[model samples]
Target: MSRFSLVRSAPAPTPAALAAPPPVAPPAARVESKPKSPARDAGLDLRLRLHAKLIEELDLAKLDKLDEAELRRQVLGQVTEFARIERMALNARELEALGASIYDEMVGLGPIEPLLKDDSINDILINGPYQVYIERRGELELTPIRFRDNDHLLRIVNRIVAAVGRRIDESQPMVDARLPDGSRVNAAIPPVAIDGCSVSIRKFSKKPLTLEKLVEFGAMTQSMSDFLYGAVRSRVSTVISGGTGSGKTTLLNALSSAISEGERLITIEDAAELQLQQPHVVRMETRPPNIEGKGEIRQRELVKNALRMRPDRVILGEVRSEEAFDMLQAMNTGHEGSMATIHSNNPREAISRLEQMVAMGGLNIGADAVRHQIAAAVGLVVQVMRLSDGKRKVTHVTEITGMEGQVVQMQDIFVFNRTHTGPDGEVFGEFRATGLRPRCLDEMIRRGIPYDTANFDPSKVLG
Candidate 1:
């Protein structure tokens, strides 16, 4: 038999094999059993032990002074050395992966670093130590990534919040923060989370999407984009309405690009995520109360304060509560190009939600007065929706003309008429112009904003 076949079907040790010298290990190489731990993968123990040893021996201060490339190289070298010293049976590829994981644990968010590095992943959802999910291309899928245990996951959660100067624990229970790249983060732990620690991250694109990019993605037609550009430049107050994860903020950001460079903009959010490209922009974020519950800053307060900042326009990240009242006030009282987003099914529902949120401010004004205020303030309601096929499109671009008594008058300028879903689950639809000329058209003309009147023709079907 051949030597390989002899080894595979060995009945007894060959005399030549028994006489060969044993393989030599590195001088410092040694193997030791790890202390017993619950919920940790058996494969993870060696890497964890090597990581701990590297941490114990590395010069952290010196490493921090090096640039990223050099830092990675030196850290990886140490990781490989420690892996060898611990007698790890890793091939070259496995060693490289181990080194990268250890490097990320040292300088990044540990287990989920790879997911964060993946630009295509739009969201990261951590249900617990053992379950992680990612939303890629608008559809959710489970991933193999996991923490060593619940404590490991909590350490990551705390690391995230602590970097942003926030706290999440039994006392606070929940917190909202943003990554350095402006991705929104929400975390809950322990008593409130029920299933260990849970974290939801809404990641934004590194390069923000513009209106033209949205057009290429079939989000809106060129005519709609033209109308929106004219509307924003002409100082039309607008509200973007959409359901959760339906691209409200994305549309708002794209629309903000239409504003003049000379205009000073102020943005407010629960966790600041808007990427307005204007030079003269001020961003504000709300704060949760301390453990004493005395230092909370709400969006309503920020909205009121933004008015004092002499802003040419106020761009609210969202109008979630009583802040809707203040936002409408800004839109009415000379902050004409101001914009905000709201959660609703359609343009009419968005109007109703605004009226309800205005009441939430505990104002003494009657409902008809509130409706009139909304009608006067918001010039357009751009409704966006994520369809069943995972594609987001502008479903409606309805204009608020005025109030017809207690009812606020509105007209659909552009509407997406869905025909059917294809066999491959793609939504088939056409964006149609209602042909009803918006009142804002006269204002756009008066402002000398160039736009084609034929864009509003009923027969003109847009993409």
Candidate 2:
């Protein structure tokens, strides 16, 4: 500084020079931009573009490789980049949150969630995710709940099958399971499904349908309910018949509610859907095989076991197979008031189906023996049907009048007469009583029970 001052003594160093060179302008408060690398920027752009295209295609097969959280992150990032390029005014944080919520909703919801929520939907059919169908009032209709692809649909199907301890692969391509809500589920995949993966769920009520509810719904007249209650009280073995979705199990449950609370009831079924209110009721269900193909139990096995339980009545959910033989035997041998359901169009067909199922047991019994057992076991057959107008009604109530020759003679004590249909597409029918006067009624009267023949007058009741 002395040398500099000597050299420029003429001007004498200015106060500015002495004052730290005017503070050097404080470096202009520079904002440092993140250094951009051409190679890294290009690589990131390439990755984002590829991921955007993949997401646009909704390719579940490849998306499945990523975990749900990672997929959500990537999707949100791509969406943000897209909005930025389009000069849109979307809040980045809000868009990311929406994407995460949508992903969770689509992934977490089960395939049957929509159908279960729809009150009008009585049944749900999943012929893969792209081919969903539903039944409303006994009619089937297709829906549109498609998956991203076959892989996604299969993933859901596999999840359901695995949860139920069933397998639906190329080898065991078909499976029958039940939902947690007691809905019946059947699934098929790959070679068996043919049309990708398929699933069918027959939804059941979470609550048992009572007799009073059935009467309120006009499924049967109150007189019919009273008579059926009388029949149940009289210990008359009865059978209920109906086609699919005709409320067979619903009717069976209602009838079981009429059973005396003192009686020890034993109920057997393939899937255990019956809801009897009696405290003494014993419920039994069949078991499917494990993955090792061991520990299988059938309805017939349960029925055979129930015989040893000393049941006052054996209630079979539905006699669809050889279990009919054991059920019929139980009913014939002192198990009065025993009841079961069968798939049939009418009373005669119900008898025929029972005989055929009894023969399916692989026994050496002749058709005559089967008929005799059925006639003796089943004293009453009440056939219900879901009409075209979506009303369930008891179409026929027949009393088995014992065996005549090789056939079971049945007398129709009550019949449904279609009066007409109202403008609202409602069916109006009259449940008329036939004055045949069942032979079993006299026995009920003799047991000090009060059942008057005057109640059978159709003119007084069917107005």
Q: Give each model a TM-score.
A: 0.89, 0.73
Model 1 vs truth, CA RMSD:
9.9
Local distance difference test, candidate 2: 0.73
Per-residue C-alpha lDDT of model 2 across residues 1-463, encoded as one tens digit per residue: 1132111123333333322211212222323441121222332232333333433445455566877667766566544544455454668676665454345334533445657767677788776545677888767887745554456577767776666566777767777776666677777887776556777777777787788888888788777777777787788999999998899988988888767788999988776667787899998877777667789999999999999998999998888999999988898789988999999999999999988888888999999988888888888999999998877988888999998887789998888888898997888878789877877787677666676566688676542
Over all chains combined, what TM-score does candidate 2 have? 0.73
- Count steric clashes of candidate 1: 0
The lDDT of each candidate is 0.84, 0.73
Best by lDDT: 1
On the 0 to 100 scale, the lDDT of residue 234 in model 2 is 86
Clashing pairs in 1: none
Model 1, which residues run further than 4 Å from truth? 1-40, 61-64, 89-93
Worst 10 residues of 1 by lDDT: 1-10
TM-score of 1: 0.89
